[model samples]
Target: MLLASYKAIRPGMQGIANRLIRWRLDGDYSHNEVVFEPGDGVDHLMPDGTCEPDASGALWCASSVAWERLPATSPRRPGHRGGVRFKRIKLDPAHWDLVKYRRDPLAAAQHFKRREGALYDWQLILGFVAWLFRHKASRDTCSEVCTEAGGQLEGHRVDPCTLHQIVAAEDRHFRSLLWLAAAGEEAAY
Candidate 1:
């Protein structure tokens, strides 16, 4: 069965925030997404129009950028102009029924739908400096959406890197799921 996965984006702008995340995490991923379902005909991770349904039959994805359902293909952020890398996660099927496993992607999708049109939590960018001052706004961030959907981040502020690290740590079976889908390059598994 396909489980929720995360994608790291490398916007071409190389903005200071993106660079800082990369430097702090020591990785190139600046943003993350929770895969609601896998794409058909194409690689499951390829941002195409095909999102397969789970046993629960949910079609929506918890996307901060899209007002409705997440597109089959990744939507370009207003200012981001870089390639996206899909992290190839492999979850042991035995863990699917666990309470921890059941709460993500699907829950996140529902949450996003409830908060549709909510502004992106730009204040999260200052998460590092204002680590102690929790944000009380009713908004979301790319990573925050994934973490919440995954039922991982327990109200703590985190960037894309921290989100990735938490997921990896929580799921010891998680592989270093890194599949580079750079522009013009066929995704390599």
Candidate 2:
């Protein structure tokens, strides 16, 4: 299955960047990621032919990240560091919002897998904060990559909050996953 996961800021050092992004963008979320499940055409990324959720019901996710040490499930460029990678994240239900994809999960997963190890788009991120500092090149950011893969808000420079709003407003192609969605209630994140 395919899910679009949005993350809220945490506490301490880990959340500093997130806090800045949220402040600058006026958003509730700070990061975006695509989650994958086993038997969803990403078996190679799963260990021992099965992908399991952690105690908090978290699972595998793919995204272009910066300054992170998570190992890549399939590195597009072995020598280059910091870019798109697959990581097993334990997402606290309270701090995350999950949007389920209504179309072919395998297609989205395949499109994302191809971007593994792509360089992190620092220039684009900088541009988000300061318009004059913006530069676009052959790199990917967390939101840009996930949005493209999911075929949502395509060809747009979106942040976590924007993406979350788009998905939350449009229910035809996306919806809150059952586990995270309250009974007949909207997602909190």
Best by TM-score: 2
Tens digit of per-residue lDDT, candidate 1, span 61-130: 3435312232324333323322222222233333121112334343554454454445566555566556
Name the 10 consecutive residues with the lowest summed lDDT in model 2. Answer: 171-180
For each candidate, what is the lDDT? 0.46, 0.69
User: Which stretches of candidate 2 lie above 4 Å from their native place?
Assistant: 2-7, 38-41, 44-48, 54-57, 70-72, 77-81, 152-156, 172-189
TM-score of each: 0.50, 0.76
Candidate 1, residue 84: the lDDT equals 24
Q: What's the residue-level lDDT of 80 in candidate 2?
A: 53
Go through the candidates in order and give the clash count of each. Answer: 8, 0
Tens digits of per-residue lDDT, candidate 2, 1-189, equal 545555666678658988888888887788887777655666664533445676676688878888775463455665456787777777667777876545466666676667777788888888876788764556788888878877754433788788767766665433445534565466443
Judged by lDDT against the true structure, how good is candidate 1?
0.46
- Count of clashing pairs, candidate 1: 8
**Local error of candidate 2 at 25, Å?**
1.1
